[model samples]
Target: MSRIGYARVSTIDQDLETQIVKLKAEGCDIIRSEKVSGASRDGRAELATIIDFLRPGDELVVTRLDRLGRDTRDVLNLIYECEQKAAFVTVLDPHVSTRGEMGHIVLTVLGMVAQMERRFIKERQREGIEQAKRQGVYLGGKARLDHQKVKDMHEGGAGASEIARAVGCSRMQIYRILQSNR
Candidate 1:
């Protein structure tokens, strides 16, 4: 059985070295890596690719369960997918690996805990936003640049790359804001 590794981090400033080193020590034959926020569903290309590459008798290794997915549902879904392929999964640092019936039960419990945590965080965030609105305080951060200027730049045929560089933000950030305005 081949040990396949996956590593992820939320931002470009962070490195995947730690995860890579650990996975290598764990005897990973191949390592998939990505720099993307866990909060972003669109940033799971590497994850999808790694899952597809897994096969029977192959072991998917991750530094932590969270490294494999965003939360509980995501973790369970990934585990289920691996099972469907007859693949095994192991979270090295946590010393959790699915080998049989009891392991599945533990995975279920862990998934539920993760789901609950996510729900709690979302509820608190929603409550905070509502409280802020009631108090007439701003809920969102200030825009990086004036909207009219951004519109003018867009109208003048400036690309998102140039606009974002001029505005001191990311191209994806500028694109997302512009797209959401429509």
Candidate 2:
């Protein structure tokens, strides 16, 4: 049976080295990784590739159940898909495998815990942001495209496509900026 590994992180700023190292150490024949949120199965091309290419008797490995997914239903669905292909799912941490019946129960419990933890993290973040706003210290996210610059360029006869290319942002974002100025 082949050991196929999958690694994921929520954002592009996060590191994937640790997961990759662990997967390599585990002797993964092939490892697919991506920097994308595990909150949804959507837009995760690497993960989709692994699932699509899995062969019967192959083992899909991850460093943790959370790396596979943070949503309980999503995690369960992924496991179900693997099982349907006759492939096994394995999580290194806490060491659960779908090779036996007990593993299914444990994975379900772990998936629920992971989903709960994600909700808790989001709640804490919202509270922190509210506190910052009350203190008048929340300037909000850094502006990717300068509003004044875009406005000036537009007034100077620059078109939406031109401003978007110069500002290194999407044309849709440029259109939004122009609309907000109206």
Q: TM-scores across all candidates?
A: 0.72, 0.80
Candidate 1 deviates by what RMSD? Answer: 3.8
Q: What lDDT score goes with residue 85 in model 1?
A: 91
lDDT digits (tens) for residues 90-111 of candidate 1: 8776588888788778777876
Candidate 2 residue pairs that clash: none
lDDT of 2 by residue, 109-130 (tens): 9999999999999999899999
| Cα-based lDDT for every prediction | 0.81, 0.93
The weakest ten consecutive residues by lDDT in model 2 span 164-173
User: What clash pairs does model 1 have?
Assistant: none
Shift of residue 54 alpha carbon in model 1, Å: 1.3
User: Which candidate wins on TM-score?
Assistant: 2
